[model samples]
Target: MKEFASIDIGTSYTRVLMGRMGDDGVIQINGAGVSPSQGVRNGGVVNIEQTVQSIQTAAREAELMSGLVVEEAVVNITGKHLKGENSRGVVAVTNRDRVVTESDVLRVIEGAQNIRIPADQEILHVLSREFVVDDQSGIRDPIGMTGVRLESEVHIVTAGKTALTNLRKAVNAAGIRVTNLVMSSLASSEAVLTSGEKDLGVAVVDIGSGVTDIIVYVDGGVFSSATLPWGGSHVTQDLSFGLKIPMEAAELVKRNSGCVQIAAVDPIEKIELPAMSGRPPRWVLRQEIAAIMEPRMREIFELVDQELMRSGKKNALSGGVVITGGGSRVEGAASLAEEVFSMAVRKGNPLPLGGFFDRVDGPEFATSVGLLIGAAQSTDTARKAPRESGSGWMQKLRSWVSENL
Candidate 1:
């Protein structure tokens, strides 16, 4: 069994999952480990030293448990600097009256690559949303069809160069090669989302400790992705400020008592908060606790809605919203999302990849699991001869190795 590892460097914690590919094409988890993430805030690495330490700790623990030499890893990245936009490209068929060939499709994609990206940023992904052939529309594939014009509408995702460089440096410092970088929300969606959901239109919200990342998919591609610099940490901060408690204690309480929907809280319910230095112990009502969280959660959901509308995908998401990540684990979150979006909402869990992963399956593990899947896909692609290389398979293989492998 060949083994691979995936690392998710989140705002609050860094996690690593080691997976072994089976003969049946199913990937199974062999080991998993996590450590508190430092030097990361709102999705960007602020301290390279602290980030490296966390990555090394998680990777080492995973390696020790699985006995696999972790050389290459898929790293997850996200932040406000990650931006996405929609673009269209058109290409005329070489034989205007003849059937559109695979080369024609490639040409259309190449045409779509024209975007005014900043010099400090790089293209992470160019996902085709839909294909249009001649005057006809909504074509999935144009090959073998006669068309004069081939057009492709795609979504482009780009990230800051400095942030990406810092992340790659941290992974390299851990003595591991970054196989590829994937957007955090995209990674989470890969873990929990079904093909049907994406085809039907859906939204994914990945809430970490210091940021709440949102992505919406319509017409089988990402329509929008944005980050709100507020997450579980904000709720903890609220508790610390409102109750005058320590940050740690506030976090514990928020986790134990936080409820996004008021109906989930009982008016008579009371919680005895831990005492702080020179402070008397306080008993807080559940409703009061909900009060602090409701506003913040409301604000986050509103921002997501605003983005959905801005992307013109608000009414198109019939598949509703799928929420994941550590913060999404809070009680009453699904109901709160339902209220805010007025649509079906569900808490998403990591995709079942088989084996011990079922035991540790949760929203927080979405990115790690998705990274493994993405790594496998990338590995498979690398093994194949790229079409752009040349006509002959042998020549294409040699070119791919020279350029990419």
Candidate 2:
């Protein structure tokens, strides 16, 4: 068995999960913890001391529960500073029989990486979208194929250098070495999406407290990804302003009674509003609260739709959209998303796990669980003989860049 740990540092909360993959191929979760986040905003660390404290609080809780000490963890990263673009490269086959070999695939991906990158940013992920052998496109595995040329299309994700430096510093200060920094949306997808959805083309939207992340997949690979600067926190702020209530009270009410579609709420059901500084408590219909949440949620979905259209994958999403993260728990979120995107929508939760993980089967735990799964898979891959090229080579290239660049 190989033990692994994952941390999801969000704007509103920090989550830690510890698990192990047994020889039976089952991932058993042993410990978990969640702590209110401080000194973090929009998924970026603003105050190192407070962020460190939050990480320590969450990690310590998980360690105590699992009875294991955590020395390293796979951490998640998200922010407005993330950017992605698509590029393609082609190379001549060099094998004696003119067959596309692993070396040719690696050279092609290296050629694709020759694009110009910004001075203040570093590449975080180089994802293989598709492979083409000669004039045959959409070829997933091109090795051993009789072709004179090999081609690849890849999507590159980049992050600002300062943002990465600050995140690493915060994690190190929390007394844990950062094993890997996975994109928040990518992690969530691993927990929620199935192979069928990816092959048919799907979009995964993770709406956290301060940022909304998007990942689009087509033909079982990543096509595009992006992050918006607004999320559930903005909804709470809107309610606080519109309802004349404190922010804390607004957040509580939103969690308890909020719905994005007024139609889903009963007409006569009412909720009590907490008393403000100078006013007595009042009872308001649930529909009234939905009125405040509907517009904002609709706007968020519209922005996500716009992003999908911008990626040129809007019409190609036959599998539709899957929404996860804490914000997805809000009542009527799926209905609102379906209305805004004019397509099918569903709420996403982490895939089932064994051991002491019943408390973490919700959408809010998707990123952390996915990070754990990713870490275990990466470790398994590292233990095996390295692949000569293709997606495996792309993964190896990313690992190298993540550690060196």
Candidate 3:
């Protein structure tokens, strides 16, 4: 059995999960924790001390629950600083008789890594989208195939170096070694999307507290990824301004009475506004809240639509859109998205993982749970690497990179 842990640092909260994958292939969750985040803004670390405290608090709770210490973990990263682009690599088969081996595959992927990037950016993930062996295109795997020419198409995700350095500093201060850093949208996809959806072409939009994350998959591989600077907090700000309430009150109202579609709200439904500053409580029609919320939510969806069209994969989404994360929890969000995208839309809840699954089943916990999934996958890769090639760390990385292929 291999034990694994994951930490998801978000603008609103910090979450940790501990679990293990048994030798028999069963994945069991053992512990989990969540705490209000501090020193983080829009997924960037602003204060190392406060970020360390947040991570430690959450990690301690998880360790207590599982009766185990978390010394290392897979961590999630997000923000507008993340960039995803597609690149192609081509190489000739070197062996006699033209049989493409794992070495050829590795060489092609390394060639794909030659992309030019900004001085302050570093590659985070290189996911193979497809392989072509000679004349055969769209081949998922080309290893052991007979081909003189091998081509690889991959999606590369990069993050700002400064952001990553600060993030690692916070995690290290918390006494946890960061094993891997997975993008928030990619992790959320592992938690919410199914094989069918990814194979048929789909977009996973994770609307987080401070920023929205997007990743589109076509033919079971990443096609495009983007991060929008605005997110659910902007909606709360709009409600605060529109309803003449404090931010705390606006957040409360947005959670309880929020609906993004005016048509979905009941005409007579009303909710109580908590009394504040010695003012008596007041009643606001739920539809009135929706009225204040609709325009802002519509604007968010429109922006996402523009991004999809910008990716040029808007029409290729046969599986349409799946919205996850806390921002998508508002009532009528799906209806509003359906209207804007002119296609099917659905809420993405985290898929069940058995133990503690009930505790983290909501869209808000998708990234945390997905981090655990990534942890198991990485462990699996490491365990199989030596058997595959009798090599060390480089082979493990190659296996990790090839997982998407």
Candidate 4:
């Protein structure tokens, strides 16, 4: 049995999950922990010390519950600083007379990795959506195929080197080795999206406290990703500004009364608006609460739509959008998304792991669950070593210079 620890350092909270994958293939979740986030603001780490403290808190809690000390963990990365781009590469099969081998696949992926990146960033993941050999499309694996020209289209995810370095520092300070850094949207997709749904085409939107992450998948892999600066915190800010209430009171109102699409409440729908100490409480109509929230929610959907169109994938999604995270739990968000995208939408909660996971199976836990699942799946063949075409990083540097200079 292989035991691994997973941690999700999210905008609003950080969570840790410890699990054991038995030899029989059953994954047992032994323990987990969540702590209020401090290091991240809108998906970027602004305060390293606070972030380290949060990670330490969660790690200690997980160790306590699981009775196992965790020294390494698969961590999640996200925020507006992340960028995804599509690139295509074509490689001539060197040994035309011999059957294509795994080396050929690696060569193609290496060819795809030839792209320009900024000085302060590095490519984190290169995921192939499909492969074509001699104009034959939709081939998942091209090995043993008899084609001279192999082509591949891959999605490359990049993150700022400074951001990653800081994250690593914080994790190290918390006394954990960073096994791998999985992007937040990809992790969320794994936790909430199923294989069939991805094959059919689906967009998973993780709307957390500070930032919203969108991941689109079609034909069985990630198609694209987008990060928006708005999320649940925006709603809280709106309530605070519109209701003339304190931030904390506004937060309470949003959680208690806010609805994304319903602006007008029935005459009977009334909620008590808490006031600051020494101030009189106010009786507010539910409609007033919705009135403040609907526009912001609508704006978020509009921005998502605009981003989809910008990526030239506006009409490509077929399974529609699946919304997750604490923000997704807000009432009327699914309806709002449907109205904006004219497609089916559903709220996503973490999948039931059939063990200790039942306690943390909510949208907030999606990234954490994804981290664990990623740690488990990291052992698969998908993670192959790069062919020694001069180290992958060196090749990336050369490619960047070729394009930028």
Candidate 5:
């Protein structure tokens, strides 16, 4: 049995997912484990030992549940150091018939990677945005088309080498091998965004604990991505300060009764705070908690809006926004996002894929599930030889689904 696995090293938590790819191309969750994270801040490893221990604990629980060891797995990468930009590559068709072929497509994509980048960073992904054949534009796939000149436009995601090296050290120290490092937002998009949403235009906002990852899709391609340094942890801090409670108790209250919009929460509903530091337990209206959370969440969405506007694609998001991750689990996040962006919004959770979906169904597990999906497909594709058929780039595209995800 081929075991497909994924590890999401989140800020507040670490998740290890164990699954198997069935013959039907769907993933079956064999087991999943979650553990509180340490030595990680904003999805980047700071303390290698602490991160290693956390990965080990989560992998053990997942292995015990599935009876499959996670020797290697696709892991997620995130942090402020990740950046995405659009680039263009043009090349001449090398075929005798002048037909765009898989080789030509590959060369064109390779040409797109020539952009100048900082020496400390390297490209992680080169997602094709569109293609052009001769004078014709907006081609999704150029293979088999007769054109002397072929062009490719792509979104290149780059990550700081130091950040990646530390992440690898932590994961390697945990007694497992890292198969691939996928961007957090791209992985989530694999699980949440529908193809329709991608073509029509949409933005996925993954509001994690220490950071919020944003990715914009237009015309069925990624146009931009950005990471904000603030996330749900800020809200917890606010609750801790305003309610005069400990961080732990504030977190509990925030999860149990927190809502971002005051109107979404009942003013009459009261929260009984756990006594901390010998202070008596105090009762406060839920609205007060929402009041504190609202401004911060609003600020986050506003920042996301600013990012969208900066991308020059703000007017293109007709499909609106899909919010996910831990921060998004807070009540009224979508509502607040819609108000801030003046567009339709919805909470994004993992789509129904296969058996044991119930175990990893929430928005928070989107990255794990997505990584599993890509891993399963990778195994299947690796077993087959690239087709020499006239369909040209189609077979390569099938392989790309797994590799690029």
Candidate 6:
């Protein structure tokens, strides 16, 4: 039994999950933890001490439940500083028989990664989208094909060096090594998206407390990704100011009775507003709360739509959109997303894994669960082919070694 761990440090909460592969090769959850996040804002660390405390609390709880000391974990990262773009590279085959080999594939991907990046930024992922051999396009695996030239199209994700450093520091301070830093949206997609969805073209929108992460998939690969600065917390802020309540009360009210679509709420139903320092408890129409939430949620979906349109892949989304993360738990979110994107929308939850996994089966656990799955898959891949280099953090390390040492 091989154990794996994952940590998702969000603006509002920090989650940890520990799992192990069973004889059947299915990952079974052994333990899980969720703690309120502190010293973090909009997915960026604001106070290192507070963030460290939160991470330790979450990780400790998970370790106790799993009865396994966690030394390293695959962590999730998201912030406004993240950027992504598509790039292409072409290389002539250097084989005697003109057949493309594994080495050629690596060289082509390396060539595609040769792009100008800011001095303060580093690449996070170079995801291969398609491989074109000679004039034939859409070849996922070009190895063994005879071609004079090989062209690769890849999506590159980058993060600010400062942001990456801060995230690593916070995780390390919690007494856990950071094995890899995965994009939150990408991780969420792993837990919630189906192969058919990825193949047919779909967009994954993970709405967290401080930021909304978006990833677009086309032809079974990431086509574009972006992070919006606003998220569910913004909606709560709107309700707090609009209803003259404390932030805590606003959050409670939103969770208990908030609906983004006014039409979905019963006109006669009223919610009791919590009494404030100088104000008495009052009854407010549910529709009023919906009014406050509708605009903000719509704005988020609208921004996601704008990003997709900008990517020139908006019309290519045939599988619609899947919404996950804590914010997606809000009532009417899918309907609101559908209205804004003019496409089908559905709430995403972590794929079912029997056993203790039932404890973390909600939308909020998507990223954490996805991280665990990714770590397990990476470990399996490494065991199968020790010589083949994996992507993401491994690729970054390889580049660093070649450039620095």
Worst 10 residues of 1 by lDDT: 393-402
Backbone clash pairs for candidate 6 read none
- Tens-digit per-residue lDDT, 318-346, candidate 5: 99999999889998888889899999999
* TM-score of candidate 3 versus the correct structure, residues matched by position: 0.95
For each predicted model, how many residue pairs clash, with residues at least 3 apart or on different chains?
Answer: 0, 0, 0, 0, 0, 0
- TM-scores of all candidate predictions against the true structure: 0.92, 0.96, 0.95, 0.91, 0.95, 0.95
- Model 1, global lDDT: 0.82
Model 4: per-residue Cα lDDT over 1-405, one tens digit each:
567889888887889999877556766788898898996988878899999999989888988998998888888888787899888888888885846666676678778889999998888778777889997998766767898889988888888888888888889988899878878999999899888889888889899998899988878867898799889989989999998888888878887778887743575688988867888878888888898899998999889888777767657777788999889988888998999988899889877774597867899888889889777655331233543332343234323322432
Candidate 5's C-alpha lDDT?
0.88
- 1-405: candidate 1 lDDT, tens digit per residue: 457788999888999888877777888788788999999988899999999999988888887878887899888989888888888889988975668877776677667878899998887766667778889898766667887889988877888989889999999988899877888888899899998999899999988888887888887777788777878788788878987788899888888887878778899999999767777778999888888888888888888888778888789999999989898887788888899989999999987886677645989898889888877665555555564332233233222322331
lDDT against the true structure, per candidate, is: 0.82, 0.90, 0.88, 0.82, 0.88, 0.89
Tens-digit lDDT track for model 2 on 301-324?
999999999999889999999999
The C-alpha stretches of model 3 lying farther than 4 A from their native spots are 385-405
Tens-place lDDT per residue, model 6, 108-195, is: 8889989999998898888888899999999877778999999999999989889889999999988899878899999999999999
* TM accuracy, model 2: 0.96
Model 6 lDDT, full chain set: 0.89
Q: Can you give the lDDT of residue 46 in candidate 1?
A: 93
Alpha carbon deviation, residue 233, candidate 5 (Å):
1.0
Off by over 4 Å in 1: 95-97, 277-280, 384-405
Residues 1-405 of candidate 3: C-alpha lDDT, one tens digit per residue: 678999999998999999898556756788899998999899888899999999999999999999999999989999899999999999999999899877888889889989999999988989888999988998876777898999999999989999999999999989999888889999999999998999999999998889889999999889999998778888999989988899999999999889998988889999998678878888999999999999988998999999899889888899999999999998888899999999899999988786667778899988999989888877876767354542343335545564532
Single out the weakest 10-residue window by summed lDDT for candidate 3: 385-394
Worst 10 residues of 6 by lDDT: 396-405
Model 6 scores a TM of 0.95
